[model samples]
Target: METIGWGILATGKIAHTFARDLALVPGARLAAVGSRRAESAQAFAQEYGAAAAHGSYEELVSDPAVDVVYIATPHALHLDNARLAFEAGKHVLCEKPLTLDVAAAEEMVRLAHRHDRFLMEAMWTACHPVIRALQKRIRSGEFGTPRHLHAELGFRVDAPPEGRMFNPELGASALLDMGIYPLIVAHLLLGPAERLTATGDLSERGIDLDIAITGRYPGGALATMTASMTSYSSRACEIATDRGRIRFDDFHHPDRAVFTPYRPGRGSWAVEPGEPVVVDGGEPVLGRGYGNEIAEVGRCLREGLRESPLVPHEQTLALLRQMDDLRAQVGVSFPV
Candidate 1:
């Protein structure tokens, strides 16, 4: 199909953002929305120009009108939503850290391959134009990436006892939410960490309040990163290479990256300012939270692709494995 019909499976803030953006994005249309409550679903559809609404995820998955399903539900529900969508013969593009663990993620991948359907982890930063440029720079030897990298993504989520941020059963934590950014940045620079040293503090409900991780690559490339929900820090992502370094403004969300190259003659560094370098960072990317991600799903569908090369299965697996290890090191465990 020239344009994709999106079935959004949540009515959360991100869902609302995505629905709004989908309205404006090329190659995308709001086919339907799903939520546990029929009223909520109907209200969302009416507010967002969706042609249909389903009170339950099952109905949304089975909606014959949709070409793709954008699983914007919580991480714990991603696997199920993907499976349902795959069964319904729809492509799947779910949010970051797609599943609670690698095992679940593997199942979703296996099913997608088995069903001959497309499935992609919604790591939007990986597909963002600015992050793509950074990757190209490193691949081109522009940065001579032979050294270390550091990325930090955190926000103050001072939730009360058993709130999502502190609730293990809900899979709430900074690492799964904000920490994925640093992990993705590191993964782009250095494939998988050969050696990982990690630790973190747990909330009262045993969810990770915060975590600090250090990963060593095969060639001695290393990454030091942190994620926290209890406190706030610089939402910066930096990749250091043998010749220079690249840093991003705020979160990697919108990809305003700056490059610094070592200057032998100057004995310091030459810099490429972040986005809008020519004029305050170019045309800023205004967005509905899920807009770009929905477009990515459409692109994959039109290409007859099963997985996004930008947010490949292996990378998602590796990042989740890293998180699992980090959580293990910190002794965070959820009750079954």
Candidate 2:
């Protein structure tokens, strides 16, 4: 197909952002939008220039023009939303933390296979140019051995109790919202987590509000990560290696990563940072990188691929399993 048709499900904040970025991606167009409310769907469609709008998800998926469905619903609703799309013979690009837990995520993946439809977790960070470039360099041993990593993402969420950020039914957990970024970054730059220990503060309803995690990764690499909804964090990340250190601010949409080499200091065993080397994601970052993922989905559909190499099904499932264990450790659990 020369162009790919996208049907966006849900008209929430993230959906708006994705819709705006979708325009930046070539060979991609907003074919339609779906929301439980007709007004919301129509407004989203008009704002994003979608060709059509539907009051229900079923209608959106049934739109013959939509080749792929972009599920922007809450974490708790992803499985059902994806099931709707898959059963309707449409591919899916669901938002991250794919689901509330591993079991749900697994079922979603199975559904994709059963329907012979493409599915990808919208883990845009993996598709980011700078992060991808950094991963490539670290994998090549360009920065020597990455011995330790630190990442934190946080912002005081002032949403009401019934809002998505604070509502337990909506899968509101700081780890799922903010912490997953750190976890994914560590997994990318360091490796799969070998052992993890977690501690956190939770709300009366049992949702995590603040969390800190320490883990051991491949080749003995160590990582410290934090996610919080009740405080302000710098959202910075760093990887320390024998030869140098890589640092970036606002890892969520970082423009570049800087690597500073180590050199001998005053003492025989001491070392200090030298001049820094800046790394950029080779291609232009289209609208904070969401466009890259949109482009990836279009590329995959055109190439007849079921999963993305950058954000593979295995990786999505692996991280969900880790989060499940972490939530258990932190005494956070949602109602069934």
Best-matching candidate per TM-score? 2
Query: How much is the lDDT of residue 208 in candidate 2?
Result: 98
lDDT values, one for every candidate: 0.78, 0.93
TM-score to true structure, per model: 0.91, 0.97
What CA RMSD would candidate 1 show? 2.9
| TM-score of decoy 1 | 0.91
> Per-residue lDDT tens digits of candidate 2, residues 169-275?
99999999999999999999888999989999999888999999999998999999999999999989999999878999879898999887766674533444544
Model 1 stretches with alpha carbons more than 4 Å out: 264-290
| Residue pairs clashing, model 2 | none
lDDT of 1 by residue, 240-316 (tens): 77776667766466446766667677657644455222112333353733555566777778888898877788888
- Model 2 weakest lDDT span, ten residues long: 266-275
Cα lDDT of candidate 1 equals 0.78
Q: State the TM-score for model 2.
A: 0.97
